[model samples]
Target chain A: MEPDVLLSVRDLRIAFDGVEAVRGVSFDVRPREVLAVVGESGAGKSLTARALLGMVPAGATTGGTIRPDLSDRRGRRIALVPQDALSALSPVHPVGDQLAAAVRSVARVSRKEARARAVAALERVGIPDAARKARAYPHEYSGGMRQRAVIAMATVNEPDIVVADEPTTALDEEHRDQVLRVLGERREAVGAALVLVTHDMDVVREHADRMLVMYAGRLTELGPADEVLARPRAPYTAGLLASLPEHAPRRRRLPALPGTPPAPGALPPGCAFAPRCSLAADACHATEPEPQQVAGRLVACHRWADTPDLLQEAYRASS
Target chain B: MPLLDVRDLVVRYGTVTAVDRVSFSLEAGETLALNGPSGCGKSSTALAVLQLRRPDGGEVHFEGQELTSLTDRELRPLRPRMQPVFQDPYGSLNPRHRIRDAVAEPLRVQGRRPTPGEVAELLDRVGLDPSYGDRRPHELSGGQCQRAGIARALASGPRLLVLDEPVSALDPSVRAGVLNLLADLQDDLGLGYLFICHDRAVVRHFADRVVEMREGRVISGWRRP
Candidate 1:
């Protein structure tokens, strides 16, 4: 493992009912960096993030290894901000009490001190009148305020890494940006790295320092966010980018990638994405391509060299 | 005449005013989008236009006839001309019923028994396989379920579709496919669409005219040249 790396994941595989959902995925989280995991539904991005905290659903089997074993140090060294703020919080208790309880669980502190820390955490996340708001239950707080309270709870223990899974999927654009900004600021203040799992490309472009694109439970591309967005090296990544209404030219129809992702149990013989890739060839269907160095990134495609030209041709043909 | 028109629409819940004097119009074969943040009364306006919720004050004119002045019995015949497609596909559909039955429901409500072949045709028209008609809503993917919803909406032979966040829940790739299907349907049927969406990029690409809303009022609007 590199000395600067905070966590190293190697050949991680998660399966259920004798079928693999995440097949041999590997990546690293560097210190204090934001790493965004981008993929569509059933692509196993959420399962991968849950595996980091040893929180995969029951009946699922996990393989391979995660260095440092941060699962045991969940609250103190690693924390999770789930999608539904209400579920993460208990409706019966006051918001401040829950956060204070979280602090007291990890550290030996008086109730007064824990309560004080909780209020400060809420204040740090831009919660107005933190002391007064602390007494309110989860249901009493508004949607945006509840999200901020969850962020405060996650950062109260000052974990080394925070894994947020689709934290703003239910929010509109205005509230989504506000939540992301608060999450970013809180993580930076606590000096913790963030592993954000989201399908929104705009969120990745704005918040991520690095990005990992997943397709059919496998790594398709991993590189610096800006570089990958500017010039994608994998066909799947390029297709996903082109499908965004904001990225494509002003037209009636977008260049959508045809076909849906193969189900986990019914995956194709070779590369899982071959059925949908416009750049697929005989070699692509014959064997799954391994990730290799290509243009300052690691791309898993048999025809990485031809991706740029082929993509341009495909766009022109469609238009 | 415009396909649909509203003047000074108003909706209230108890003492709170949700849609305060909002107005917009749509022509056949065109898309008019209602874009705004949450709690901006976009959904209220849609419900009012559909007459699912009677507006407290306004004139809703559809096909040169005023809808607000009509009674329940009078509106019954006109209801088939306008339909709604909601956000959550699974929630919008009856989980226990098969897709074929769901698609046939609109015709059944109008005192007609649709043939199975007609149901299959509706399924095929929305880009779904005819075999999908046999399966329940849960058996289909999110995008497929949404397509099934659209098929049901089309069964009514509606001239206008009130699409409330129709593709917001699907993946990006699947959303594009659904959007394209909607475009083709509009062109073929000459149907007007009242699209309600929050994503600015999608609204820009899909709507022929956009009415921006804030706090239940139209803040701005634009149309393609």
Candidate 2:
């Protein structure tokens, strides 16, 4: 791994009961880079984030190397802001105490010391009246404020890498914009690697520096955010971008991919996405394609392995 | 004439003006989305449409009939024409009841009970396995529970369904499936939907007509965007 690479995940395979939920997914999150992971529900996007945090729940198992160059088993160097604030924060405890707990966990400071640090973290995330709001419980705060508290916990220790999983899922437009801006600012201010996992295509378009498209349980494409989205190299990536409602003005119809994802336990032969990909040929069902660089983009499709212009043509036609 | 019509609607919750002078009309088979931030009174207006909470002023008409003039006993039988799909699936479904019984409640409540064959058909129609009727609400995921809720709401064969952030709790990827299902149901049944949500992206995709609200008032008149 390069010295600048803050977190390098190689061949991450998360499985449960002999079924692979995330199969050999590999990517590098560079310092000061906001890497957005965009995919559908069963795409194993959240599982990849959970692997990095070392919090894969029961009945789910994770293997392969998640290189943590930032810290050892010492625990305070990584933090996450999950999608649902109600589930992430403590219901009974004051929001200040929860933020302080994060500080204590990472810094091993006194309760008094952690409380002071918590207020600073709140202020950094643009929380108004940081001191007063710190004492409020999670339920007392609105959806936007609860998200801010989550960001504070992630920043209290001042970690080098922060993971946010669908951070704006349940928030209003104003709140969603606030949370996205906070992540963008926090990543620049602290020089931390921000990995945002969401299915919201707009978030990836507006906030990410790089985009990684996952279909089923594998990474199908990765490159510069706008380049990958504008001219997606993989059919699955193209399908997802086409389905998004933002580009509806340019297209007459929102092109929806037919059928659902196969059960994770027994995937289709060859490319996992072959069943749904329109460009899939006979070879896609017989051989698993490896990630290859095509026209300055990383893609995992056999048909486009030789020519990226074909992907561009197909993407435009579909939209 | 419109299938559902509301004019100069106002609702009060003890000095709090929940909905102020809101006006709209929903034609049969057209989807209307009422979108706004929290406490903007979208839900209040929806509940008032069903007469769940009596409005302070204005008129609500369905198929040339005024709903405000109906009494409790008179309204009970008319409820089958409009149904609500609430936010939380787990909370909406009765935890103690089986799936079959829960869905059948709406049918039974209206003095019409479906046979076991019909109940099995309803479950399968909503994409659930017919065998799933015996399972309890706790046995299903949030998405599955919501499908059961949709089945229950559809049991009475309502012409209009009011959804309050129906898929908020589901994963975004799963959310698309539900949205598609709703769209498909509208086509097959020729039903209208009052879809209330705050996601502009969703409104852009699913809504036939978009109405934006702010500060307990109709900020914009109903129109197809």
Candidate 3:
């Protein structure tokens, strides 16, 4: 692991009831970097994020090492901003108490000091009237306000790493942008790495510094976000980008990938995505291709060089 | 005349007005998308148009007929012409029933036993295999279940489909496919659609006209030029 890297995950695997939800995956989160893990619903993106915080489901066995830079503390050095903020927060208590609780767990601060810090944290996350609103219960806040409070709670102590799993999924377009902006600001303010797990390609393109694309519990592509969006090396990644209606002509048919992802424990032999890949060759069906370094990006495909042109042509045709 | 015309529609719950004087028209074979944030009254306006919930005030005209003034019995005959495709296909479908039975429901409701060919054809039209008719909703993926919902809506031979966030619940990989399928169906069947959505990108791409709602009112509407 690099000296500057805050979190290094190596050969991470998670399984439930002998079903491998996250097959051996390895990645790193550098200090002050936003690494987005992007994929569909069954792609194990959320599972990977959960594993980093050691919050995987009960009975789900995990393997491999997660080395988070904890030179400053002993316990968990990471915090999580869950998808549904309303449900994640305690409904019975005022929002201020939850924030103070998170702060107290991380530090040995006095109660009054913790409460003042809670209000400051809420203010940092762009919540207006922080002190007064902090006194309101979770139910009293709007969805966006609740999400902001959750973000405040997560970043109260300025952990070394933050894992936000679909944090803006439940919000509307306006709130989605607001939450994302607030997350970016808080990450920069705290100088902490952020692992954003979401299915929205547009969000990844806009906010992520680097992106890792997953399919069937395996990483298919990993690279800088802008480069990956402009020139995807994996067929799945290209198909996902092209499938967005915003990328295609107004009335043209979207380039949708044909089949759904394979279910866990029921994955087919060879590459799991071969059935849906339009460019799949005989070699692709023979065995799963290992991640190969190509063009400064890690891509697990037999024909990475050929994908950019194929997808570029499709995108151009749409325009 | 337009296939469906809604004028100054208002829907209220107690002191709170969910939809305030929303007016729009859906021509035959046109898709009119209503875009807004959560709690913005777009869904309420759609429900009011369908008469699923009675409007406090305003007019809804279907084929020159005033829907707001109709009684339940009076509206029964017109029900076949309008159908709704809800957000969660899994929640909308019957868990224990087979796919064929679910798709055949409208036909049965109309006093006709669906034939094997009819069920297979309906499934095929939605891009599902005929063999899938034997399976239950739980056996299918989110995308497949959504297709079944569309097929069920089509079973009624509706001229207009009020799609409430139809593809939002599905994964992005399958969302485009469903949207394309909806577009194709509109072209082939000359169906009008009142698409209720929170996604601005989808409204821009899929709808012929775009209407934006916020704070229980229609803010502005425009054609997709």
TM values, all candidates: 0.95, 0.84, 0.97
Ranking of candidates on TM-score, top first = 3, 1, 2
Question: Tens-digit lDDT track for model 3 on B53-126?
Answer: 99999999998899999999999889889999999999999999999999999989989898999999999999
What TM-score does each model's chain B reach against the true chain B? 0.99, 0.97, 0.98
lDDT string for model 1 (A75-128, tens) is 889999998988999999999999999999999999999999999989977788
Q: Per-model C-alpha lDDT, please?
A: 0.89, 0.81, 0.88
Cα error, residue B84 of model 1, in Å, equals 0.8
Off by over 4 Å in 1: A1-3, A309-319
Docking class of 1: medium
Candidate 3 regions with alpha-carbon error over 4 angstroms: A69-76, A308-311
DockQ scores of all models, one per candidate: 0.69, 0.28, 0.84
Candidate 2 lDDT over A1-319, as tens digits, reads 4358878899898888978989888988888899999877778999898778887868887777988644353236777888777887889999888888877765667889989998988887778998999988888887777877887777678777788888877666776777677667766787777899987777888888898888778888989998887777787777666555555442134455655566687689999888877778899999888888886878889987433443344456646
Q: TM-score: which is higher, 2 or 3?
A: 3
- lDDT rank order: 1, 3, 2
Which candidate leads in TM-score? 3
Q: Which residue segments of model 2 deviate by more than 4 Å?
A: A69-75, A104-116, A249-253, A305-319, B8-21, B53-58, B86-109, B112-157, B167-190
The window of 10 residues in a row where model 2 chain B has the poorest summed lDDT is B169-178
